[model samples]
Target: MGAAEHRQSPVGVRGAVAARSVAVHIAVLVDEVAFLLRPRDAGWVIDGTVGMGGHAEQLLEGSRDDVRLLGLDVDPAALAQAAERLRPFGDRVTLARANFRDVRTTAARHGIEHAQSVLLDLGVSSWQLEGSGRGFSFQLDESLDMRLDPSLPETAAGLANRLSESDLARILAEYGEERFARRIARAIVRRRPLGTTSELVAVVRSAVPRAAWPRRLHVATRTFQALRMAVNDEPGALRQALPEAAELLAPGGRLGVIAFHSGEDRIVKQTFRSLDPRRFAAVEPSPLTPGDDEVRENPRARSARLRVLERLP
Candidate 1:
């Protein structure tokens, strides 16, 4: 079991300590999200992927005392930290261990049928990348288990070691958008039973030519991202969640999505554009990105794209 699960209470002292240590994991584009959502006018707010409660805490602080929020996440570790971080809000804050794809039913079960604003920060949190020990980062030497939800049956190790070269290549190419997907898949196939992040990283390094490596990003970044997305079925989850969120939006309600990968952004773009123009409107011609200063402080925010949709009153 993970360290966070061992604690008796998520809002207890130990979880509080863990929350404090991860203060560096900034929630990307907080100001922009707050501006679009307008917490002051909100009655029910749902942060569909409330990692570490950064956005949730800010919304509570910025809104009226009665404005309640229902926070959902697949990551138990993140939810625990969020519970600790949002403890001061008392009963106004309600959290559930759930995937964003299940937002419609989860919200109903919690007695929230519709919300004035919903925010889905689809990027995996910095805490998950740096500290979760879940093999989300290639820089980490942890085991090759990238399942964000422990209940997930497949692991990165299972996909890498078990799949055929053609199948693995397709996953790399489609999910990660890796140019050297076939080469990487071939390398992985030759090196079977890979069990650690380092092992997979080594195989990727050997597959791509030295000169072909990306100058700005790590050689294994895309590979790790693709594996994580595949193991978690991120694309499928996003497709399911976006429509459900739109359905639960009240008139004049705003739904915001933060996407880090091109594939993720594409899905968001298409879904938002496909909404009925008479009822729902794309708030902007394009997605909003982090300001230069925000990106400077957190390099991970460099690729973040936020798209918003609002129901017409």
Candidate 2:
């Protein structure tokens, strides 16, 4: 199959555009990721969250055929999709089935010791949002399984049912930045036996006033984000991954992170600030947002924020 064909023919697609987004629609963002890398020299690069191989393939496409890519992903489906997406690069691309938190070890195992650039696009990928049956959206009525990796023990349902109401409220408030976290958590606890995305959505909708719901994007949105974060321990993994990326970079190497939420952006900003100011200079003090045109084309790009930091030689 051609490169374009390979991307669209994934497991399942909800719509024509969504299918295409999984396929070739996102290739353009690859340039943005490569721009952050700015190789400087022909050293290796690591894509810590190489989802669908969108960025990695583009980086390899412009580099010498022998340039290396050490790509990592915790989701098996993502790794599989990336393997196919980057098959054109052959030996130049090395895909790993691992979490971003294990980036340093994964890269080292592939013999990529001094990375020239590292790009991590945190959170769920579009493919996961559309294809993975992990119940990532309130739009879907599937199981309450939000674990990015199904191998994990606790699913979103488990957490929703098991976590103390206070803990659940905190997760929603802190990780999801939801204003009505306490009310949502209390409603969830009261409406026990929550088993699917629809059930969770209903509980949240009922707990939130109609007028208040419209002020925010959607009543169930934050709750979904909160559960996914908890299921994947996304913040904890990111906390470990960013420092690992910093340590793994060669002198003068650059690191870029694409975060989708404030909690993540705060972590990236604070961590970069705490590092050696001279050794690590910010490339974009303010995170880069998608252009209006890009967002118009793909609404998913709306919340994306890209931040870059480069190490001193």
Candidate 3:
């Protein structure tokens, strides 16, 4: 069992003392889950990407006592955090460390083959962005490690530095939709010893037009996104996961997905369309975007788009 599972509850005086020492960890887990899942349904729900349990907390809050949840994530760190945050609900919650692609398997493991509502927040967690020591942000010069699960062997740096220029270009084009993929790939090859995020960022800057710098975020933003997706097989994962989620949902079950980029959002949009309308229907012709006030409070949510679909009888 992890520290989170073993930790005492904050119900007693000892729990109070422990709280002072571990306050930051506790606070983050609570705060994160609160922001991710917006639960309005009064039935079993699944948080397919329960990163740090941010959305899970919100879902639990919006639900009645009978409305249970099955939370899943590939990251063990995220799972540990979730375990703690949802502990109050006890047996009412089931937490698992696994990719969302196995939605059916995950649900079955939790004795939940079907759910009335499913929410997938596909963005990397703030914990992963800030403290994972993996090179996620260009702002950090850390080692280029973007694997969602730390147990994974491949790292972003290995992909960026190892793949052939042509292959690299293709990844950027397909995954990042980057226009300067060829230039970026060629530049990366020339700078073969790329190790840190900043180093890669500098190379990308050299490859793109100087005028494009900062105006559209970092020039290397797309390149980094491409590498992360390829390393993690995220797009492929989504293709598999969405359909699995659709299959596992009960009649009248609703599935909601929050995608952070156009590539991801496109996949969700198309997948929802491909599902038979006789059996399932899109809840909205368009996805929902974060309001201006929400964006002001949480800039990371600016790119989010939420799409909900309902399974037919």
Candidate 4:
């Protein structure tokens, strides 16, 4: 366990106060994920993006004692939180700091030959947005460092400061799906060397027309998303991990993915379909969305879409 894990809330006055002040991240689509994964009596499970071990905890609690879990994550802080959260499970749980793109290799290093179930919950975590000063949230005015793994060479600020206008426009248009990509890129280039989240937010707000500003979404949302994606190479990672995950699944094993955006959903859908039909089958023709009650309680889950596929025996 890391330092953060050791500092997790305990049964004390200060712990109680800290717990009350901090927001708990609710695991999205828990029931749906459990239903799709359907943990076997005695098998290994892999949680590719085990943020705080929410889904992993549920799976372990809901499964037989013989079942084991291999949880992987890019962020060391998240792994620390997960280590503390999953400590009760004892030796049944294994935690590793790694990107999901290297899931197969990481699992192999840990002596996991194959997985009976695999889960990839792709998107930003509440902890990252609320606590980490990584600038994942546009509402918070922090440094423009959006790398999930701090070791990553690129930062959002570096991209904003260095990339040419056309390249930046391409990233916004392709990754963020921003309509005013060129305008925003031009404005960002003109400003050059944006240091903080507030600075970037101001640039975005200024670049877009007042009438064009979205009512529900902040103007800076797209640009931040684009930069984060570029810095992390999220799409590329997903593309590589999908095939590796599919190959790592035991016969009749299931792969469930919860994607929070259109780009991710599209990639999952296309990749699953492109898999050998004789070896794989879609569990559902369409994606499952969070119910109204869940969305009302956890607004962050509103955009979640879950899809599952099974390996043929």
Most lDDT-accurate candidate: 4
TM-score of 3: 0.85
The digit string of per-residue lDDT tens for model 1 on 1-313 reads 2211211231232223223322343588776666667455537899999889998987777777878999999988889999999999999999999999999999999988878889999888877888989899988899999999989988999989888999999999999999999999999999888999999999999999999999999999999999999999999999999999998887778899999999999999999888888888877778888766677788889999988887777
Q: Write the per-residue lDDT of candidate 4 for residues 179-294, one digit (tens) a residue.
A: 99999999999998899999999999999999999887888888888899999999999999999999998887888899987998999999999999999988778888876667
Q: Which stretches of candidate 4 lie over 4 Å from their true place?
A: 1-25
lDDT tens readout by residue for model 2, 165-241: 99999999998888899999999999988899999999999888887885537778888998999899999999999
Positional deviation of residue 195's Cα in model 3 after best superposition, in angstroms: 1.8
Candidate 2 accuracy as TM-score: 0.90
What are the candidates' C-alpha RMSDs? 9.5, 8.0, 9.5, 9.0
The lDDT for every candidate, in the order shown, is 0.85, 0.79, 0.76, 0.86
Candidate 3's displacement at residue 191, Å, is: 1.0
For model 3, residues 199-256, the per-residue Cα lDDT tens digits are: 8989998999887665746778888888989989999989999999998877766677
Task: Sort all candidates by lDDT, best to worst.
Answer: 4, 1, 2, 3
Clashes of 2: 1
Candidate 2, which ten residues in sequence have the lowest lDDT sum?
2-11
- The residue pairs found clashing in candidate 4 are none
Global local distance difference test of model 3: 0.76
- Ordered from best to worst TM-score, the candidate numbers read 4, 1, 2, 3
Clashes of each: 0, 1, 7, 0
